[model samples]
Target: MTTWLITAEETVIADGAAPHRQIEIIRKVHGNKTREEALVELHKAAKSHVPDSLKGTSRVVGRDSDGSCWILPKNGKGHPPCVIRFVEQIHP
Candidate 1:
């Protein structure tokens, strides 16, 4: 299975300030994969779980040195699975 690291952040909408608490998760998927591919899968997976109001605002945050993508929810608060999810590589 492929390994992925996920992190979460809580931010304020008024000032666009720093996140309140950041959480991290390490998960395994089907197999080895690239960061981009993993992010796509993560986005797909997260889309369903995200609230309808916040769905359009979700976005991938950053990439770690190891190439793992940090997926984060934007424009709101209280996001679940607030970390990273892994997926198989489909292309270069």
Candidate 2:
């Protein structure tokens, strides 16, 4: 079993200024399951729990041991994108 944490991030920009790029952790969940299972469950949780401000932004997916390892855009309709934009091996 594995534990996962998912976060929603966006490039916040001030009025008429440069974007204050940052990645904010919008949600975090822990589960006892295989990596594959955790990913599935986490995605489901993210879809339901992500805040409205992050509804159409990118997401940061990570684990307890490592920092965020994946960043992908949100589907805007309350779902993760069909394609993952980034991924890193979390286990050997």
Candidate 3:
């Protein structure tokens, strides 16, 4: 199976407020799928892990040439809220 590395930066809301915390995530996804398909799956997986309140305005960011991916809020400006990187191999 091909391995896909996924990463995300999450913004935590404190007391239900704006811009609370930034959480970084890196995960390995295994499957024989195309890059587009893998991206979709990764988005689904990432969405499943975040809180429901943040679902409607979340997005994924990555560069194929650079082999990087990330998740961020839709309304964010400048850098993404979270950044992710995908790798074919996993390190211990």
Leading candidate by lDDT: 3
- The TM-scores of all predictions, comma-separated, are 0.35, 0.43, 0.40
Ranking by lDDT: 3, 1, 2
TM-score pick, better of 1 and 3: 3
Q: Considering summed lDDT, which 10 consecutive residues are worst modelled in model 2?
A: 80-89
**CA error at residue 18 for candidate 2, angstroms:** 0.9
Model 2 segments more than 4 A misplaced: 49-92
lDDT of 1 by residue, 1-92 (tens): 45554333333233467445443333334456666776766655444344322456755455556644444656445553244444343344
lDDT by candidate, in order shown: 0.47, 0.45, 0.55
- The order of the candidates by TM-score, greatest first, is 2, 3, 1
Superposed Cα deviation of residue 17, candidate 3 (Å): 23
Report the error of model 3 at residue 33, Å.
2.1
lDDT of 2 by residue, 1-92 (tens): 34454545555556699865454444344545565665565556544554444555675544333322333443444433222111322555
The C-alpha stretches of model 1 lying farther than 4 A from their native spots are 11-19, 24-27, 51-92
Q: Which residue pairs clash within candidate 1? A: 6-83, 6-84, 7-83
For residue 12, model 1's alpha carbon misses the true position, in angstroms, by 9.0
- TM-score preference between candidates 2 and 3, better one: 2
